[model samples]
Target chain A: MVLVAIILSACAPGTPDEDSWRVDALRSIGDVSSSVSSVQLALQHHDRLFGPYLQTVAVQAEDAAGTASTKLSAVQPPEPYQGRSDTVTSALDDAESLLTDARIAVVRRDSAAYADLVRRLKRTGDRLSRIEDRIRALPDDRSRP
Target chain B: MKKLLNVALGVLTAIGGFVDIGDLVTNAQVGARFGLSLAWVTLLGVVGIIVFAEMSGRIAAVSGRATFDLVRERLGPAMGMANLLGSMGVTLLTYVAEIGGVALAFQLICGVDYLLLFPFVGALVWLVLWRAKFSVIENLFGLLGLALIVFVVALLKLGPDWSQLGHSAVSFQPPKPEAWSTWAYYAVALFGAAMTPYEVFFFSSGGVEEKWGVKDIGVMRTNVLLGFPLGGVLSVAIAACTYVVFNPLSASVDTLGQVGLPVAIALGKIGLAIALLGFVAATFGAACETGLSTGYSIAQYFGWQWGKFVRTDVAARFHLVLLLSTVIALGVLATGIDPVQVTEASVVFSALALPLTYFPILVVANDRDYMGEHVNGRVLNVLAMFFMVVLTVVALAAIPLMIWTRMGA
Candidate 1:
């Protein structure tokens, strides 16, 4: 009885006409939700398209390095390229793999695994972010321009 | 002299209570969405918090027991346990959300992803809980969180139309095209954010922690009366900033970065940086509060000694629960779930669970056995009863509204 009364009471009248603002706010919310959904989709694509290839590269890189110095030197490039190309490729591959795992988690709606994969992907993203930062920090003469 | 000190304590608790992650998001979200139409909710919440907080504080002062402690004694174990479970679950979820919030704020400022910051933020919270003196940890973050005043400065910089804002707040019709469900959902969300279970648990627990006796009743009263409303002002400032900035852009705040954007626009990077610091402090402070309250409720329920006043070795189980709660929160954040979404859900869940925690406190406050001479007078009872009715209604409507609005779309 009291519960019914409570429910009815909460049905109080709301704010008056501001239809335009309401549509605008709802649309804005929809756009943000769509953006988030899109990001999730992109992450899925990264995993499916690039994940296995990266794992193969990682294995090959491991095989190429019979010794510590050889492994380091093989991964390293010339003066112009430095060690960045290999690092960038490897990192991107790792990110794509993580994204793939994240996509699987998302499919399963596993909040825990989805969170973990997102964390892993974020780390990969951070590595990329740092590479960009370092590249930007370099003198203009070193740039393509 | 003691009277003055009590007033100061009230102010500090109110400050501590005002700026949880829910307030950070809800105030900003509503401000962005409806301008100040919902600003009145914050005021209403302040009044609600004050009324209930005073009652709980007075109950503690007179009975020499915190809110939950009396809840068990008065309501008996079964009902109290139900309240305990509901309140504790909501509080724990809130703790997880706040820890995530702090990490997200760090990500915003440092250009690091929030997950990377999760372990470190978790460790920092644990370190504070483990080592820092209770009063010091409480005062440090509670006081430092005042940096959130940057929001107020940003609001001033934005220069909103005050009369228009006042009209929106005073005019209570559901704005056009907004499904009544969505409006009510956000309304319930705002209400839940304002009267989160942790606030009462923390407030009542703080009263007990500070050793409030019957003589301390006046001090407790003043704290509830003044501090909460002041905190509401900060919430208003956040919402108003969003109203002025995001409303024009029609930007919905889905991230901590967006929440801080108005500050960034108004005061530039420096303001954004400080506001982020405030966000970190406020959320981290709340994390600690919820974490501690998790252990406090359990310990108090079973007749175990609890609180920061005791040493780690003496309160082994209490410390253990606190440690585990922080670990779980860290784990949740590491999963990379969006903290903002978690905070939204936490506030909604808190809204649904409101009556469980609050009704008991109201009942206890009016009990002659518990409150004695300090029992709620006629006026306080009337006000408390009214808000109780309000809270119960919001709780019931919260879930259906969420589903209907698709979590407010």
Candidate 2:
């Protein structure tokens, strides 16, 4: 019963206070960052990777990024933290878009586009990582209920 | 020489069949996040499993009965029901995940979506369970799963700093950026993955299916003692492979493809192809085992005739349970659930189910009625008692840790 209650409360939608909002936002960022880095790694070894394996990895990355974007978007951030939430969500959007492009390149087996896609993915991934670090460094002003 | 060959085969199969989808995903995820810091959990879990499995095998050998059959007789129907519910529940969940895992493996190989392949994977697993002989199902997939040895080869090819890996293995502390709760959560997951209930259920039941008596105890002991540690080595090799490749990048393994990526990085296309084969065999093998385990637990509890040693027609209800389980598992997967998520849940719940499944074995093993002169000795009793405490602690901690860590978010 306690487990069910905790899970139910977690699923209930409410505007999280600043600290929890930051934690949720950073989790989304971390997920997208991991997905983006997966694509970068897969693309770097595309020649050695099987075509189907490459496609599967790329598609999973895109799905993960898409899910992170949707999850972060669903979070009703408290008024003061709305800007930070939007920034993280926007970064996720970019990551999702890059992942989609990477997936297409992988499906088409376009070696020529691989280099640029890897570069873009790494840059976006690095940006997401930096965002996570910044959020981690932020002071937890648990002022709002 | 024939007897020697039989022992050799049993050991080889045990080593190959040791890893299932849970071990594959959890070990890779831990290695990626914590390096070798959690390696001790896998070792601890392996020893725990070996202790119980040997006792269960001994029970089967001496009593001419499987674990669940003896569980009900020794512990009474009420406690047997409790064990059945916990162990069978996780085994069924694991059954679904292993079928889906096979589809995922096929998807990686053929570029088809796993959803498209689920029905076929489900049917194929059912067909094998229904048609294959006990030893054939055990040996074919187990030997094929030896392809996972590529992980050992992959780790060597990666040329990791041995001293650094040894240091992490001994660290016992979580690495930077990991909290103790998160480390503890993964530790429980690793233990759960290493010592899932189905393995023992399958082992004890398989002994019955093969019609083992006292003479076969030597072969069983050889397999458990020699085979399981080697299998543990393979588990650590998988972690070390991912640790060498993904740890430096601070990435996590969230997909099946990522679990096999380290092999591609180290040994190129052929190695990747071999790893994919390993995935298919390991998951498919476990799918068969867990599927049978579900039937074994229920039929044995209900006093229905069970075991592949009997004709399918003779053990009608047991076969029916296997068929229904496959259809239900497929039904669950048809709703488009993520197999990896199912795999994760199965391991955690497997931890929760550990004591329920294991305590009965310890009790029955000590009962002189079942083991005339073969009751657990003082030394073995001390060891098993220690593990019982550990299992109880792990079982109690599993859900709370899962909740607190938000499933190791």
Q: Score the docking of each candidate (DockQ).
A: 0.02, 0.61
Query: Taking the tens digit of each residue's C-alpha lDDT, what string does model 2 give over B1-409?
Result: 9989998999889998999999999999999999999999999999999999999999999999999888998889999999999899899999999999999999999989999999999999999999999988999999999899999999999899999999999999999888899999999999999999999999999999888899999989999999899999999999999998888877888889999999998999999989998999999999999999999999999999998999999999999999999999999999999999999989988988999999999999999988989899999999999998988999888888887777887
Residue-pair clashes per prediction, in order, are 11, 0
Task: Residues A1-145, candidate 1: write the lDDT tens digits.
Answer: 2354457546733323233223322233233222232233233333332232222222222221222123222332335543444554454445445444554554454555544554554455455555544443343434442
Query: lDDT (0-100) at residue A31 of candidate 2?
Result: 84
Candidate 1, residue A11: how far the Cα is off, in Å: 23
> If candidate 1 were superposed on the true structure by all CA atoms, what would the RMSD be?
15.4
Worst 10 residues of 1 chain B by lDDT: B248-257
Clashing pairs in 2: none
Model 2 ranges off by over 4 Å: A1-15, A140-145
